[model samples]
Structure formats: C-alpha cells, structure tokens
Target: MLSTRRRQFVNMLIFLLLILFILYSSILARFRTPEVALDSSSGSFLTKTYLGLENEQAQSELISGSSLHNEGQFVSGNPQSSLSSLSSSSNEPETINKVSTAGVPSDDVNNRNHISAEISSERSVLKSEKKNEVEEELHRILSISPVVIFSKTRCPFSVRAKNILLKKYSIDPAPHIVELDQHPLGSSLQKSLAALTGRSSVPNVFISGQSIGGCDEVIDLDQKNILATKIYELGKQSIKVQLRQTT
Candidate 1:
C-alpha cells in the first residue's frame, strides 16, 4: 500500500511541473510578441521613408521637365538633360539677338521700298509735265519778235547765218536770236524744233512766226538777192502796224 501511494505522488508532482513549464512558455511568447511588432513597425517606417524619397524624386523630375519646356525645349528620359539645359541657357541671348536683328531689317526694307515708290511716282509726274512746259515755253519765245533766228553761237552754220542777217542786212526791226547751246532747256527745245520744222540743226530762221528754213536756205536766199526784198516787205508791214497802234 506504501509503494502504491508513492507512485501516485510522483505522478502528481510531474503534472504540477508540466503546468509550471507551460505557464513559463506562455509568458515568454507574450514578451517576444512586442519585439516582433517593433521590428515590423521599424520595417514599415523604412519602407515609407523610401517611398517618400521616390515621390520627391518624381516630383522634382516633373518640375524640372516643366521648367525645361518653358525654356523652349523638349527632353523625355534623356540622360543629357543637364547638358542640354546649360547649352540652352548659353544660346538664349544669341537667339534673341538674331530675332531682333531679323525684325529690324524687314522694317528697314519696307521703309526703303516706300521711299523708292515715292521717288518713282514723282519722276513719272515730272516727265508728263515736262512736255507741256517745253511746248508752252517754245510758243512764248517765238512770239517775242516778228523775225526770229534759233541758233547756237558755237555752230559754224549759225555764225554764217548771223553774219548775213546782222552785218549785211539792214531793216527797221532786228532779228531776235536764241543761243540754244547756252539755254537751260536746250535739248528739249531742239527736239521740239525738229518735230515742228522737220529740221534738227542750228541757224533755223523764222519769218513772221513761220520757220523759213536753216542756214543753207538763208544763204541761197541771200545769194539770189531775194533776202533783201523779203526783209524790206516784212519791215514795212511791221512799221505800218506800229503806226496804227500809236494812232
């Protein structure tokens, strides 16, 4: 009966020991849970920080890309964006100067074209008016005297004609001589005279506002003795008109 009691006591002691061991294991598991949770929280914080850094880097890239676009450039995923930015900064002034210079030349060219157009218009107007001026002037000079001689002083034919009319002939009124070579509108006058009388030379002789001929005709008339008679008749007519005006 003692042996049986001792065996039951041993079994009871083993059961109590097992219970204490189980309580100790449960306490250790509870303590280790906090450390595991702290480790997990720390890992989560690290991941969040890494994600924040990535977000900041992405935002920075977007801002830089926008700024580059504003500067008149486009770069997508290019490694040389920094170099491109520096080059753009360096060339910005040159580009501005080129644009300004280009604009100024266009303005200058437009101004020059405007001035040229005005000058051309004025020249055309003057050309049209010159014909009338020459014609009117010729008529005025022709009416200055009854007998007119259109001549140049340097012309040999004119010198011969003047010697015959001025030195050899004597009349009541003198012949009005024009030195076309010394005249301001000499060339235009010569052209008009040629168109009117069909003669383009000096020593053109006119009688009573009518072109008789040139030096050859006058020499022929003087040699034929008809020049003196013609002069006397015209002189008498002019004197009679003057006398009537006076009366």
Candidate 2:
C-alpha cells in the first residue's frame, strides 16, 4: 500500500510540473517577438510614406520657385515698356522743332517777317511823301524872284550881304530877302537847301536858282566889281522872259 501511495505521489508531482510548464509557455507566447516583427514592418511602411511625402513637397517647392521666377520676369517687363513709352514721349518735342527748322515754317516766324516787311514799306511811303512836299516848297520859293537870298534876321553877315547886293548893285528884280529865323518852316527849308545845294548857312545867296555861297563870297565878288555886271545881265534876261510871257 505504501509503494502504491509513493507512485501516486510521484505521478501527482509530475502532473503539477507539466501544468506549470504549460502555464509559463502560454504567458511567454502572449508577449513574444512576433509582435516586435509586426511593429518593425509597420515602422518601415511609415518611413517610406514619409520619404515619399518629403519628395513630393520638394518637387512642389521647385515648381513654385520656377513659377515665382517666371512671375518676376513678367513683372520686370512692365518697367521696360514704361521706359520705352517715356522715351517716345520725350522725343516728341525734338521732332517738332526739327520739323519746324526743316522747311515747314512756324506761324509765329512768318507773322514776324510779314510785320517787318509792312513796317519797311510804310517807312518808304512816308519818306517819298516828305520828299515831294519839300520839292514843291522849294519850287514856290524859287518862283518868287530870279535872285533869292536865304537869311537870318539876327545875323549881321546876312544884313551886310543884302546891303551889298541891293544898295550897291541897284539890281532890277531885287533879291527876295527871306528871314529864316522868323519863318515857320525855317529849319525844314534850311535842311532842304543843304540837301539840294549843299548850303545851310545864313545869307545863302542864289542867282537864277543857283547857290553863290555865304556873306564873305558875296563881298569878295562885289569888291572884284564883277557882281554888278552879273546882276545887270541877269536883270535884263529876267525882263525879257517877263515880256515874252506877257505877249
């Protein structure tokens, strides 16, 4: 009976040892390296996905950078076009000045030339009228007598010259004494005489509308005794002309 009891005890101890061994194996299998292998595979998949995403982002950044560069080129073209327009605008006035100088006369310049021509013509007309008036006056003075004397009232030389021609010679159709200082158109007549006969002094003596010069010349001619003979001959000629006109 004791031997059977010992065998039974041994069998019970072996069965208990087998149950503990089975329990330990099941616990170890529940937390094993297979799970670690699955985690490793999943981590590898995640790393590949991350790498792909980074590559795509880099490509997008490159594309965006290229687009920005193209946009910058487009933006820069606007300033060039504006500069071209400014250059064209600045050249417009220069072209206009060139055109004006070439042969297309400016209106203002033409107007100025026309005005200058008109002024010159007007001056010419006025000068011609003045000359005609002066000539008419000269003819009237000469027709007064054959012998004419231009004299000044205040000049002693003119008085002496008149005395020599009138009192000493006793000339017929006696010299017409003109007092220039007392006359209204005296200065004008003197200037005209200077222009016509080259004589402008007092006692400018004339015989038959011819200048004989001033006081000293007349006295000299009288002292030489030729003045009385010249006067008598001119007087006879004047009387003959008057008689012929009367007939």
Candidate 3:
C-alpha cells in the first residue's frame, strides 16, 4: 500500500548496498599477507658449522692426531700422508744391500758382470765341443772309403753314372754306391761331406780318395780312353793275384 515515489527510493538504497558489498569482497581478495624469509646471517652461520664438522671428520679418518689422555683432536695438513700410509701397508720395505739367492751380492754391479761372463764362457765351450764331435764323425766317414758316390734311387743322373762304371768298364762299384735317398742318415752325412769337400752338388764322384766331380768328369775320362786302361789294369792285377793264390 506504499506510494510509487516511496517504492523507487527504497529500491535505490538496496542496490547501493549490494554494489558496496561486491567492491569490499574484490579488494579483500587482491590484498595478500606477505611471507617472511629466514635471516641470511643465521643461515650462513649454520652452514659453516656443518662444513667444519664434515672437514674434521675427514681429517680424523685420514690420521690419528691427539694423545690418548687428552680428548683434543689434530688434523693432518699433508696431502701425501694418506697415500704414503697406504703404500707402506701394502709393501714390505727392502734394503739396497740385500743379497740374491745365487749368493751374488746385488749391491755390486761388478758381481753381476762377472756372473754373466762366466755363463757366456760355459756356453762357448759347449758349442765348441759339439762342433768337434761333428768333425770327428765326418772324418771317419771320408777316411774309410777310397771311392764314394752318393746317389738317389730314382735319379736319372745316378742311373747313368752307375751304368758307365758297370756296363762300360765292367766294374762292380756296388760297395761304393751310397743311395742317399734310401738311407736314414744319408742326407745328413751327404750334407756334412759336401760341406767339408767344398762340393755343393749331389751325385758326387770320388776315385782314389779324390773328388773327380760328377757324371761329366767320369764321361770325360771315358771319352779320353783313359777309363778303359785303368779298369783293365785293376782287373788284370786282381785276376793275377787270385791265380797265384790258387796255385
């Protein structure tokens, strides 16, 4: 039952109260309380104390510093002390004047030199003795044979040389024929004989304890007609001696 003008005035007052309420709420949301940080000097002091404790612990681990009666601890300042202690624990100390198992004095260089010289002289003597033994064996082989021929079974040159003595001269050189390829010691003996006689080739021909070269020399002597005369003289002497003994 309120008049129109009175109603309008009431509506305006209510609108104004609602706007003021919204403005107050927005301002309150924008304005925040400031956060306080810890003091820098206090934090730094705490950090230094922690680092000092850690350093003391490291020093104590590396070296035992103080007297047993006193509780005070000392820190090692030398950097090499830990390394030196590790090395000493690992290896036993050795003296420079220690002697060896061979009874040689390790302290003197002259003793080592003398031992080396003696070892070398012994090796030289052993080598010389071996050489002399080989020489004696070779000498025996050469001195026992008046005619020696080293040949191979399958070699054409060996067959040709044998044929010249047997068929042409009618001389049986079987006892003097050395088949080098068939014998076990033949190769080594042939090499030694060849080395001593200064003949580097094989199918060697030696007559009257002399090396007459190879097949070519024998063929040359046959072509010269001297081979037949020599064989005839050897055969005649043998036959004559045999006839006299039988009579």
Candidate 4:
C-alpha cells in the first residue's frame, strides 16, 4: 500500500506541472506584441543632397535682403531701388539733380519743348480752320440777302439799328438779320465778324455784303441823310436782280 501511494503522488505532480505549462503559454500568447512589416524604400543620396542645397540657397537669399518669391528663382543682390541713393553722397550732386528732374536729360527737355511748340502750332491751325468755316457760313448768308446784319437779339444797339433799317426806310426785300444770341454758331460768327470787319461789337451792319459799321455809324449816316439814299439804291439793285432771275 505505501508503494502504490508513492506512484500516485508522482503522477499527480506530473499532471500539475503539465497544467502550469499550458497556463503560462496561454498568458504569453495574450500579452505578446505583434511584429510590423517594414518597406525597403529609402530615398537616394542625390535627392537628399539637392533638397538640402535648395534650403541653404533660400536661407542665404533671405539673409541678403532678397527672395525667391518674385520669379520663383533666387536673385543675387538686395531688392532695393538705386534711385534712393540720391540722398546718400554729397559729391554726387549732379546725379542727384538729374534724379530730381525725373532723370530726364537736357536734350530730352529740349525735345519736349519742341513737341509742345508743334502742338501749339497745330492748335493754332485748327482755330484758323474753324474761323474760316465761320467766315464761309457768314458769307453764304450774306450772299442770299442784299442786306445782312450781324446782331445780337439782346443788344439795345442791335434793336436800334434794326428799327432804323427796317422801319425808317422803305426798302425792298427786308434786311436779313442774324440774331447771334439765338444762333448755334453765335460766338464763332462774332469772332469771324470781328476778324473780318475789325468791329468787335454787335449791330455790325452789312449792305450788299459791305460793312456799314455799328449802330453808332448807322445812326450817324441817317442823321446826315445819306443812309436812306444808300439803302434805296441797294434795294433798287436787289429788285432788279430778282426781276432778272424770274425772267
């Protein structure tokens, strides 16, 4: 019976050891860290070297007061303008003065003056052409009537002259009156008339395309009794011309 007990105890110990081994293996499996797979894709040395060089260049350009932002390429010098150097040195007064004058040379100034004079001459020509057009229009109006008066509707002198010429005299074909105040080319006509007759004021009377002067002169001629004679003679002439045209 003692021998049988000893073998049974040995078998129990072996069974216990087998159970402990299984428990340890299960615990190790639960807490074990998994291994990760790594890729073999390291970049080449040349690419790393080029990236390092570009970073160094960008840093250098930033320190030199310039940047690669403008053209996406680094520039060598500071991005400041040379014009600001005008106030720097006292010995460069002539250069400073040149810069002060907008850096334009003396020859360029002379050329500009010449161009300005040419433009002034062109403007003068245009004015003269406009004046000629006004004169031609005035002449056309005068040709249609035996008598023409360059007068302003608002002028008392013009009213006075109209009254005398149209009311006092029994002239045929009443005088053609241009009320400059109401005309579109009124100011231009006045300028043309002044240039032609040398009489700048209104009430500029024209008899048979001839200037009979202003209101003062017309009244003077009437007081002398020659104004009526001149008007009737011109009226007779116009009547004869009309009669001939009809025939």
Which candidate's lDDT is highest? 1
Q: What range of 10 consecutive residues in model 3 has the weakest lDDT sum?
A: 238-247
- Per-residue lDDT tens digits for candidate 2, residues 179-207, read 88987778788888998778878889877
What is the C-alpha lDDT profile of model 1 across 127-209, one tens digit per residue?
87998899988888887877789999889999999888876776446778889998888889999999999999988888776
Better of 2 and 3 by lDDT: 2
Candidate 4 per-residue lDDT, tens place, 83-170, comes to 3432354455354224225667766777799999999999999988987788788978898778888898789999999888776665
In candidate 4, the residue pairs with backbone N, CA or C atoms under 3 Å apart (3 or more residues apart, or in different chains) clash, namely none
TM-score of each: 0.48, 0.50, 0.42, 0.49
lDDT of 1 at 188: 95
Count clashing residue pairs in model 1.
0
**Residue pairs in candidate 2 whose N, alpha carbon or C atoms collide under 3 angstroms:** none
Score each candidate by Cα lDDT. 0.77, 0.74, 0.62, 0.74
Candidate 1 backbone collisions, by pair: none
Model 3 local distance difference test score: 0.62
Give per-residue CA lDDT, model 3, range 1-247, as digits (tens): 8999999999999999999999998887566222112233355766666666776787685565432325233333454864675577559665677666777667665666898999999999987776666667555655554455667888887778777765555443332677778766666667766786777566776654556677776678778877655543534433111111222
